[model samples]
Target: MNTYKQIEAEILAASNILITAHKSADGDSVGSSLGLLHFIEKLGKKATICHPDKAPDFLDFLDLSHIITMDQEPEKVNTAFQEADLIFCLDYNSTDRVGKDMTPLLESASCTKIMIDHHLDPQDFASITVSDTSASSTAELIVELIELSENGSLLDEKIGTPLYVGILTDTGSFRFNSVKPRTHEVLAILLAGGVKHYMIHEMLNDTNTASRLRLQGFAMSEKMEILDVNSVAIISLTKGELEKYQYKKGDTDSLANLALSIKGMKVAIVLSERDGIIKISFRSKGKVNPVNALAANHFDGGGHANAAGGMCELSMDETLDKMKALVPEYFPVQ
Candidate 1:
């Protein structure tokens, strides 16, 4: 049986399904979780979506009021996990990716666990895993899964919207190397299903707040530092700086991408100071593998080769020092 057939058979045999995505929920995470919930509901199954963190305002276009959040309602989250007969973990690989609070709850849940992700070196935690590291996003995988099912008609506007958001955000609006011909094929099918592609793009990118624009200007003028010899650009922001601008969850969404747009820049780094850790985002062009060298080796993080994230428990300057120390090793003066 194919992935959809196999998953659908399991779904048919079970009810009370709970779906989850990782913490600091990105577009792909929100899209896949909501999209899957809609699909399951269309199949006449009891489905609930749970996310470990709050989603950004940019994704408010999608109706996520029903999506349970651990931050907002712990009891609801716990109840959903407890009553769930089958849990589909979307977007993320490891259970811990859901965050510290949800890890044990998810790991201890006595249900058939399913993982559908497109990340590298996924842990063997789920009973069934539909992982494809090469796939653009889990939302793309979701499209394939729905097409493989007997009820391909469920890929309508409601479902296609979130799926399109996932593909658009995760693939950097079709500019990333991860995007393939199959990705566009799926996008075409979504468009044919009446997904408002241009509108979705406008919401995701053009709907920025005035404060967000001011914050971006500050990031470019005050925080950005170009390492000319190494072909790198670094933008470091402290908690105070973030608060000064009233930083929202997705305020710094594409700052790294902006930094990388400079001429001769091969790598872009965003160092953001949080409560107890420095959140790091790495963006690279060409062959430099941030997932292996920057994220995995230097910091306890990983993602795609071209775009990865990491964190450090040190002062902002200290974190920059550490990152600078590793720069020569990875980028070397070229």
Candidate 2:
């Protein structure tokens, strides 16, 4: 039997199902988890989405009431894990991506585990793994899974919308090089299934808060630094500065992209001190850029070629110094 057939067979046999995504929820993580949940529901089974933590405030427009997060209800999340007969891991590479709390529950769970992700170097933790690095987003992969199941009839606006959001955001509104013809085809299918593309666009991009806007302006005008000779831009914000601007979790998400937008900049790095660590986000201009390895070797993180993330326990100033020193070796000035 094919993979989708195996997935269908597994679903048919399972009684309780649990869906999970990584910590630091983004559009793909949440959208893929929810899209898979809706797809499972269409398959005549129920699934629970158990994220490691709450999604950022900007994503509050979605119906998140059904998701059980470890941050809010540890006991309930534990109960769900214990009760699950099948688990779907969405948009994350390894068990550790679920964070410390959920990782133990996931590792200890005796249920059949399936992972559907679009990232590099997937761990061998799941019984069934569907990982494709070339795929634009796990949301599109979920739609492909449904198509593989030969249940294309089951897709509707409810299933398509979240998946659409996932594809849109993860592809940087289809601006990223990761986008392919297959992505646009999948999007067409979703649109045919009643996903209002423009509405999703408006809801996601136009929902920026006053604080968020101010934060972005402050980051651009004040915090952002340009290393003109290195063709790099850097933005580092301390916790105090973040607090002064009423910083929220997703507030600085676009800072790296903003930095990368500068003329002649080949790379951009954004760092913010949060949760006792200096969080770093990297964005680069080329497909073969070494940002991924640079992140792996220096920061405690790794991701795609042009986009990656890492964290540092050092002070913000020290982290910035380290980053400035390290970046030149990976991406010298043109």
lDDT (C-alpha, whole model) for all candidates = 0.88, 0.88
Give the Å error, residue 10, model 2.
Answer: 1.4
* Regions of candidate 1 where Cα sits further than 4 Å from its true position: 289-292
lDDT of 1 by residue, 68-146 (tens): 8999999999999999999999998988899998998999998899999998889999999999988999999998888
TM-score of each: 0.97, 0.97
Off by over 4 Å in 2: none
lDDT tens digits by residue: candidate 2, 1-334: 9887788788878889999998989988888888888888888897899999988877776698879999999999999999999999999888999999999999999889999888888899999998899999999999998877867789999999899988998888888889999999999999999999988988888888888889899989998889888788899899998998899878888888878878888889999999899988888888546588888899978888878888999999899889988877888755
